[model samples]
Target: MNASTAWRVPSPAEIPGLSYDALVEHLRLSKVNVGHYQSVVSALQEELAKRSPTNAYRCTKCGHTEYQVGAIRTARSGWSSFFGVETAQYHAIICAHCKYTEFYQGKVPPGQQALDFLFGS
Candidate 1:
Protein backbone atom coordinates (compact mmCIF):
# COMPACT_ATOMS: atom_id res chain seq x y z
CA MET A 1 0.00 0.00 0.00
CA ASN A 2 1.14 3.53 -0.75
CA ALA A 3 1.65 6.13 1.96
CA SER A 4 -1.43 8.03 0.84
CA THR A 5 -3.71 5.06 1.38
CA ALA A 6 -1.92 3.67 4.41
CA TRP A 7 -1.60 6.90 6.39
CA ARG A 8 -5.30 7.51 6.92
CA VAL A 9 -6.66 6.75 10.39
CA PRO A 10 -8.94 3.74 10.65
CA SER A 11 -12.61 4.43 11.25
CA PRO A 12 -14.44 3.00 14.24
CA ALA A 13 -16.12 0.38 12.05
CA GLU A 14 -12.76 -0.68 10.64
CA ILE A 15 -10.94 -0.79 13.98
CA PRO A 16 -12.80 -3.90 15.14
CA GLY A 17 -11.61 -5.74 12.06
CA LEU A 18 -7.91 -4.99 12.53
CA SER A 19 -5.63 -6.96 14.82
CA TYR A 20 -2.65 -5.17 16.39
CA ASP A 21 -0.12 -7.48 14.77
CA ALA A 22 -1.73 -7.14 11.36
CA LEU A 23 -1.88 -3.37 11.71
CA VAL A 24 1.79 -3.17 12.66
CA GLU A 25 2.78 -5.37 9.72
CA HIS A 26 0.76 -3.30 7.31
CA LEU A 27 2.25 -0.03 8.60
CA ARG A 28 5.76 -1.45 8.41
CA LEU A 29 5.22 -2.69 4.89
CA SER A 30 3.80 0.64 3.82
CA LYS A 31 6.68 2.53 5.41
CA VAL A 32 4.43 4.91 7.27
CA ASN A 33 6.14 7.56 9.41
CA VAL A 34 6.58 6.89 13.13
CA GLY A 35 4.13 9.60 14.22
CA HIS A 36 1.34 8.37 11.94
CA TYR A 37 1.99 4.77 12.92
CA GLN A 38 1.79 5.68 16.59
CA SER A 39 -1.47 7.57 16.06
CA VAL A 40 -3.02 4.59 14.30
CA VAL A 41 -1.82 2.21 16.95
CA SER A 42 -3.20 4.45 19.68
CA ALA A 43 -6.59 4.59 17.99
CA LEU A 44 -6.64 0.82 17.68
CA GLN A 45 -5.63 0.42 21.29
CA GLU A 46 -8.42 2.74 22.41
CA GLU A 47 -10.92 0.67 20.50
CA LEU A 48 -9.56 -2.52 21.99
CA ALA A 49 -9.86 -1.04 25.46
CA LYS A 50 -13.46 -0.08 24.81
CA ARG A 51 -14.29 -3.61 23.73
CA SER A 52 -12.66 -5.32 26.68
CA PRO A 53 -15.19 -6.71 29.16
CA THR A 54 -15.69 -4.98 32.51
CA ASN A 55 -17.63 -6.01 35.62
CA ALA A 56 -19.39 -2.66 35.97
CA TYR A 57 -22.41 -3.46 33.84
CA ARG A 58 -24.97 -6.24 34.01
CA CYS A 59 -26.74 -7.61 30.98
CA THR A 60 -30.52 -7.62 31.27
CA LYS A 61 -30.90 -10.51 28.84
CA CYS A 62 -28.58 -13.14 30.31
CA GLY A 63 -27.80 -11.66 33.74
CA HIS A 64 -24.17 -11.37 32.76
CA THR A 65 -22.25 -8.84 34.83
CA GLU A 66 -19.49 -8.37 32.30
CA TYR A 67 -19.93 -5.88 29.49
CA GLN A 68 -18.04 -3.65 27.09
CA VAL A 69 -18.62 -0.02 26.22
CA GLY A 70 -18.82 1.24 22.65
CA ALA A 71 -20.11 4.42 21.09
CA ILE A 72 -22.16 5.64 18.14
CA ARG A 73 -22.94 9.01 16.55
CA THR A 74 -25.94 10.04 14.53
CA ALA A 75 -27.70 13.05 13.09
CA ARG A 76 -30.78 13.26 15.27
CA SER A 77 -32.90 15.92 13.69
CA GLY A 78 -33.86 17.18 10.25
CA TRP A 79 -31.48 20.13 10.15
CA SER A 80 -28.65 18.08 11.59
CA SER A 81 -29.29 15.37 9.01
CA PHE A 82 -29.47 17.86 6.18
CA PHE A 83 -26.22 19.45 7.30
CA GLY A 84 -24.61 16.05 7.92
CA VAL A 85 -23.97 16.95 11.54
CA GLU A 86 -23.82 14.16 14.08
CA THR A 87 -25.93 15.75 16.80
CA ALA A 88 -26.58 12.63 18.80
CA GLN A 89 -24.03 10.48 20.58
CA TYR A 90 -24.72 7.18 22.27
CA HIS A 91 -22.97 4.81 24.62
CA ALA A 92 -23.42 1.20 23.65
CA ILE A 93 -23.11 -1.34 26.46
CA ILE A 94 -22.57 -4.83 25.13
CA CYS A 95 -22.84 -8.07 27.06
CA ALA A 96 -19.69 -10.12 26.83
CA HIS A 97 -21.38 -13.51 27.02
CA CYS A 98 -24.41 -13.14 24.74
CA LYS A 99 -23.44 -10.03 22.72
CA TYR A 100 -26.58 -8.19 23.70
CA THR A 101 -26.12 -4.44 23.18
CA GLU A 102 -27.95 -1.54 24.77
CA PHE A 103 -27.58 2.10 23.83
CA TYR A 104 -27.74 5.10 26.13
CA GLN A 105 -27.65 8.68 24.95
CA GLY A 106 -24.54 10.70 25.79
CA LYS A 107 -23.63 14.36 25.81
CA VAL A 108 -20.42 15.85 24.52
CA PRO A 109 -19.52 19.50 24.11
CA PRO A 110 -20.76 20.53 20.68
CA GLY A 111 -17.54 22.20 19.55
CA GLN A 112 -15.31 19.29 20.52
CA GLN A 113 -17.72 16.76 19.12
CA ALA A 114 -17.86 18.58 15.80
CA LEU A 115 -14.10 18.74 15.62
CA ASP A 116 -13.78 15.04 16.41
CA PHE A 117 -16.31 14.15 13.74
CA LEU A 118 -14.63 16.29 11.14
CA PHE A 119 -11.13 15.05 11.84
CA GLY A 120 -12.02 11.46 12.65
CA SER A 121 -10.10 11.77 15.94
Candidate 2:
Protein backbone atom coordinates (compact mmCIF):
# COMPACT_ATOMS: atom_id res chain seq x y z
CA MET A 1 0.00 0.00 0.00
CA ASN A 2 1.06 3.55 -0.60
CA ALA A 3 1.91 5.88 2.28
CA SER A 4 -1.45 7.62 1.85
CA THR A 5 -3.33 4.39 2.46
CA ALA A 6 -0.91 2.89 4.96
CA TRP A 7 -1.09 3.84 8.61
CA ARG A 8 1.81 5.61 10.26
CA VAL A 9 2.47 7.55 13.44
CA PRO A 10 1.53 11.16 12.94
CA SER A 11 4.03 13.98 13.47
CA PRO A 12 3.58 16.61 16.17
CA ALA A 13 2.86 19.29 13.56
CA GLU A 14 -0.04 17.22 12.31
CA ILE A 15 -1.93 17.84 15.50
CA PRO A 16 -4.15 20.91 15.67
CA GLY A 17 -3.21 23.91 17.75
CA LEU A 18 -2.43 23.24 21.39
CA SER A 19 -5.71 24.02 23.06
CA TYR A 20 -8.67 22.26 24.62
CA ASP A 21 -11.03 23.48 21.92
CA ALA A 22 -8.71 22.33 19.19
CA LEU A 23 -8.50 18.96 20.90
CA VAL A 24 -12.28 18.78 21.06
CA GLU A 25 -12.62 19.65 17.40
CA HIS A 26 -10.01 17.04 16.54
CA LEU A 27 -12.01 14.36 18.29
CA ARG A 28 -15.23 15.55 16.72
CA LEU A 29 -13.75 15.20 13.24
CA SER A 30 -11.58 12.14 13.81
CA LYS A 31 -11.75 8.94 11.84
CA VAL A 32 -10.96 7.12 15.10
CA ASN A 33 -12.98 9.22 17.46
CA VAL A 34 -11.70 9.35 20.96
CA GLY A 35 -10.98 12.62 22.80
CA HIS A 36 -7.54 12.65 21.26
CA TYR A 37 -4.90 10.46 19.59
CA GLN A 38 -3.26 10.33 23.01
CA SER A 39 -6.47 8.92 24.42
CA VAL A 40 -6.35 6.14 21.89
CA VAL A 41 -2.74 5.50 22.82
CA SER A 42 -3.71 5.45 26.46
CA ALA A 43 -6.40 2.89 25.77
CA LEU A 44 -4.01 0.79 23.78
CA GLN A 45 -1.50 0.94 26.60
CA GLU A 46 -4.09 -0.32 29.03
CA GLU A 47 -5.13 -3.13 26.75
CA LEU A 48 -1.58 -4.15 26.03
CA ALA A 49 -0.92 -4.25 29.72
CA LYS A 50 -3.40 -7.08 29.99
CA ARG A 51 -1.24 -8.97 27.55
CA SER A 52 1.96 -8.09 29.30
CA PRO A 53 4.08 -10.78 30.89
CA THR A 54 2.96 -9.65 34.31
CA ASN A 55 -0.60 -10.55 33.37
CA ALA A 56 0.34 -14.00 32.09
CA TYR A 57 -0.88 -13.29 28.56
CA ARG A 58 1.10 -15.39 26.20
CA CYS A 59 1.18 -15.66 22.46
CA THR A 60 -0.76 -18.77 21.56
CA LYS A 61 1.78 -19.72 18.93
CA CYS A 62 5.07 -18.93 20.62
CA GLY A 63 4.17 -18.89 24.28
CA HIS A 64 5.35 -15.34 24.73
CA THR A 65 3.72 -12.28 26.21
CA GLU A 66 5.98 -9.85 24.39
CA TYR A 67 3.90 -8.25 21.71
CA GLN A 68 3.31 -4.84 20.22
CA VAL A 69 0.13 -3.20 19.08
CA GLY A 70 1.04 -2.34 15.55
CA ALA A 71 -1.93 -0.19 14.71
CA ILE A 72 -5.59 0.53 15.13
CA ARG A 73 -7.69 -0.30 12.13
CA THR A 74 -11.29 -0.73 11.02
CA ALA A 75 -12.94 -3.41 8.92
CA ARG A 76 -16.11 -3.33 6.88
CA SER A 77 -18.69 -5.97 6.28
CA GLY A 78 -20.61 -6.73 3.13
CA TRP A 79 -22.68 -3.76 1.98
CA SER A 80 -25.36 -5.98 0.42
CA SER A 81 -26.02 -7.98 3.55
CA PHE A 82 -29.57 -8.26 4.73
CA PHE A 83 -28.65 -6.23 7.79
CA GLY A 84 -26.94 -3.61 5.61
CA VAL A 85 -23.32 -2.53 5.77
CA GLU A 86 -21.40 -2.82 9.03
CA THR A 87 -17.98 -1.94 10.32
CA ALA A 88 -15.81 -3.02 13.21
CA GLN A 89 -12.64 -1.70 14.80
CA TYR A 90 -9.67 -3.53 16.24
CA HIS A 91 -6.07 -3.36 17.40
CA ALA A 92 -3.43 -5.33 15.57
CA ILE A 93 -1.33 -6.98 18.25
CA ILE A 94 1.66 -8.98 17.15
CA CYS A 95 3.92 -11.23 19.16
CA ALA A 96 7.38 -9.73 19.16
CA HIS A 97 9.11 -13.07 19.56
CA CYS A 98 7.29 -14.87 16.76
CA LYS A 99 5.69 -12.06 14.81
CA TYR A 100 2.30 -13.68 15.18
CA THR A 101 -0.43 -11.11 14.89
CA GLU A 102 -3.93 -11.27 16.29
CA PHE A 103 -6.84 -8.92 15.74
CA TYR A 104 -8.75 -8.23 18.92
CA GLN A 105 -12.24 -6.86 18.56
CA GLY A 106 -13.09 -3.89 20.77
CA LYS A 107 -9.51 -3.67 21.89
CA VAL A 108 -9.51 0.04 21.18
CA PRO A 109 -11.96 2.80 22.13
CA PRO A 110 -13.15 2.77 18.52
CA GLY A 111 -14.05 5.83 16.50
CA GLN A 112 -17.39 5.70 18.19
CA GLN A 113 -18.96 3.49 20.85
CA ALA A 114 -22.11 3.04 18.79
CA LEU A 115 -20.07 1.58 15.98
CA ASP A 116 -18.61 -1.01 18.31
CA PHE A 117 -22.01 -1.79 19.79
CA LEU A 118 -23.42 -2.38 16.34
CA PHE A 119 -20.44 -4.38 15.11
CA GLY A 120 -20.13 -6.80 18.06
CA SER A 121 -18.08 -5.38 20.91
Candidate 3:
Protein backbone atom coordinates (compact mmCIF):
# COMPACT_ATOMS: atom_id res chain seq x y z
CA MET A 1 0.00 0.00 0.00
CA ASN A 2 2.99 2.30 0.06
CA ALA A 3 4.59 4.11 -2.85
CA SER A 4 7.93 2.40 -2.34
CA THR A 5 6.56 -1.15 -2.17
CA ALA A 6 5.48 -3.10 -5.22
CA TRP A 7 2.44 -5.36 -5.31
CA ARG A 8 2.79 -9.01 -6.21
CA VAL A 9 -0.04 -11.48 -6.70
CA PRO A 10 0.43 -14.50 -4.49
CA SER A 11 0.38 -17.75 -6.35
CA PRO A 12 -2.44 -20.17 -5.53
CA ALA A 13 0.02 -22.97 -4.83
CA GLU A 14 1.34 -20.95 -1.95
CA ILE A 15 -2.03 -21.02 -0.24
CA PRO A 16 -3.70 -24.40 0.18
CA GLY A 17 -6.78 -25.24 2.26
CA LEU A 18 -7.77 -21.59 2.56
CA SER A 19 -11.44 -20.97 3.29
CA TYR A 20 -13.61 -18.24 1.80
CA ASP A 21 -14.01 -16.36 5.07
CA ALA A 22 -10.30 -16.50 5.74
CA LEU A 23 -9.54 -15.18 2.29
CA VAL A 24 -11.95 -12.29 2.74
CA GLU A 25 -10.44 -11.51 6.12
CA HIS A 26 -6.95 -11.49 4.70
CA LEU A 27 -7.97 -9.16 1.91
CA ARG A 28 -9.63 -6.83 4.38
CA LEU A 29 -6.61 -6.71 6.64
CA SER A 30 -4.19 -6.26 3.76
CA LYS A 31 -6.07 -3.25 2.43
CA VAL A 32 -6.50 -4.92 -0.91
CA ASN A 33 -8.93 -2.76 -2.84
CA VAL A 34 -10.22 -3.75 -6.26
CA GLY A 35 -10.85 -0.20 -7.46
CA HIS A 36 -13.63 -0.55 -10.01
CA TYR A 37 -16.71 -2.69 -10.46
CA GLN A 38 -16.49 -4.22 -13.95
CA SER A 39 -19.86 -5.35 -15.20
CA VAL A 40 -21.12 -6.63 -18.58
CA VAL A 41 -22.67 -3.28 -19.39
CA SER A 42 -19.40 -1.49 -18.73
CA ALA A 43 -17.38 -3.96 -20.76
CA LEU A 44 -19.77 -3.73 -23.72
CA GLN A 45 -19.63 0.04 -23.66
CA GLU A 46 -15.86 -0.11 -23.67
CA GLU A 47 -15.72 -2.56 -26.56
CA LEU A 48 -18.32 -0.58 -28.49
CA ALA A 49 -16.26 2.58 -28.21
CA LYS A 50 -13.19 0.82 -29.56
CA ARG A 51 -15.06 -0.74 -32.49
CA SER A 52 -15.52 1.07 -35.79
CA PRO A 53 -18.78 2.98 -35.76
CA THR A 54 -19.53 2.65 -39.47
CA ASN A 55 -18.98 -1.09 -39.56
CA ALA A 56 -20.88 -1.60 -36.36
CA TYR A 57 -20.33 -4.89 -34.53
CA ARG A 58 -19.82 -7.39 -37.27
CA CYS A 59 -20.83 -10.99 -36.91
CA THR A 60 -17.81 -13.08 -37.68
CA LYS A 61 -19.88 -16.09 -38.69
CA CYS A 62 -22.42 -14.31 -40.87
CA GLY A 63 -20.14 -11.44 -41.93
CA HIS A 64 -22.90 -9.10 -40.92
CA THR A 65 -21.70 -6.10 -38.94
CA GLU A 66 -25.16 -5.04 -37.76
CA TYR A 67 -26.15 -6.45 -34.37
CA GLN A 68 -27.04 -5.67 -30.77
CA VAL A 69 -24.21 -4.96 -28.27
CA GLY A 70 -23.60 -6.76 -25.01
CA ALA A 71 -20.80 -8.10 -22.81
CA ILE A 72 -20.37 -11.79 -22.14
CA ARG A 73 -17.96 -13.19 -19.54
CA THR A 74 -16.21 -16.09 -21.15
CA ALA A 75 -13.91 -17.08 -18.31
CA ARG A 76 -11.75 -16.16 -15.31
CA SER A 77 -8.20 -15.61 -16.43
CA GLY A 78 -5.07 -16.18 -14.33
CA TRP A 79 -2.51 -18.73 -13.23
CA SER A 80 -3.87 -21.45 -10.94
CA SER A 81 -2.30 -23.48 -8.17
CA PHE A 82 -3.19 -25.88 -5.40
CA PHE A 83 -3.38 -23.04 -2.89
CA GLY A 84 -5.84 -20.76 -4.63
CA VAL A 85 -7.42 -19.64 -7.87
CA GLU A 86 -6.46 -16.17 -8.99
CA THR A 87 -8.92 -14.21 -11.06
CA ALA A 88 -7.80 -12.28 -14.11
CA GLN A 89 -7.06 -8.65 -13.42
CA TYR A 90 -9.13 -7.58 -16.43
CA HIS A 91 -12.36 -8.72 -17.99
CA ALA A 92 -12.54 -11.04 -21.01
CA ILE A 93 -15.05 -9.82 -23.59
CA ILE A 94 -17.47 -12.11 -25.43
CA CYS A 95 -19.22 -10.69 -28.45
CA ALA A 96 -22.94 -11.26 -28.86
CA HIS A 97 -22.50 -10.60 -32.56
CA CYS A 98 -21.11 -13.60 -34.40
CA LYS A 99 -20.30 -15.08 -30.98
CA TYR A 100 -16.85 -13.66 -31.22
CA THR A 101 -15.07 -12.88 -27.96
CA GLU A 102 -11.65 -11.41 -27.49
CA PHE A 103 -9.27 -11.08 -24.57
CA TYR A 104 -7.11 -7.99 -24.48
CA GLN A 105 -4.06 -8.36 -22.26
CA GLY A 106 -3.13 -4.71 -22.56
CA LYS A 107 -5.62 -3.31 -20.02
CA VAL A 108 -4.98 -5.31 -16.84
CA PRO A 109 -4.50 -2.94 -13.91
CA PRO A 110 -1.25 -2.68 -12.03
CA GLY A 111 -1.36 -4.12 -8.51
CA GLN A 112 -4.84 -5.37 -9.28
CA GLN A 113 -4.95 -9.17 -9.16
CA ALA A 114 -6.95 -11.96 -7.57
CA LEU A 115 -5.83 -13.87 -4.49
CA ASP A 116 -8.02 -16.97 -4.36
CA PHE A 117 -9.77 -19.64 -6.35
CA LEU A 118 -13.22 -18.51 -7.47
CA PHE A 119 -15.48 -20.92 -9.34
CA GLY A 120 -18.74 -20.45 -11.28
CA SER A 121 -19.82 -17.23 -12.96
Candidate 3: clashing pairs of residues? 12-84, 15-83, 58-65, 85-116, 85-117
lDDT of predicted model 2: 0.51
The Cα local distance difference test for each model comes to 0.67, 0.51, 0.38
Instruction: Please write out the lDDT profile of model 3 over residues 19-79, one tens digit for every residue.
Output: 3333333344344434321222233333334443333545556666554433322225443
Residue-by-residue lDDT tens digits, candidate 1, 1-121? 3566554666556766876544555445435556655646666666556654453567889998877789988877786676667777888988889999988666656896577557653
Q: Largest lDDT belongs to which candidate?
A: 1
lDDT, candidate 3, at 74:
26
Q: TM-score for candidate 1, please give it.
A: 0.47
Worst 10 residues of 3 by lDDT: 36-45
Q: Model 1 misses residue 21 by how many Å?
A: 41
Q: Rank order by TM-score, top first? A: 1, 2, 3
lDDT of 2 by residue, 1-121 (tens): 2456234433355433223333333444444744446534443344445444436657989898787875553446544133332355555778889988887554334355445456743
Model 2 scores a TM of 0.35
Q: Which segments of model 1 are wrong by more than 4 Å?
A: 1-56, 113-121
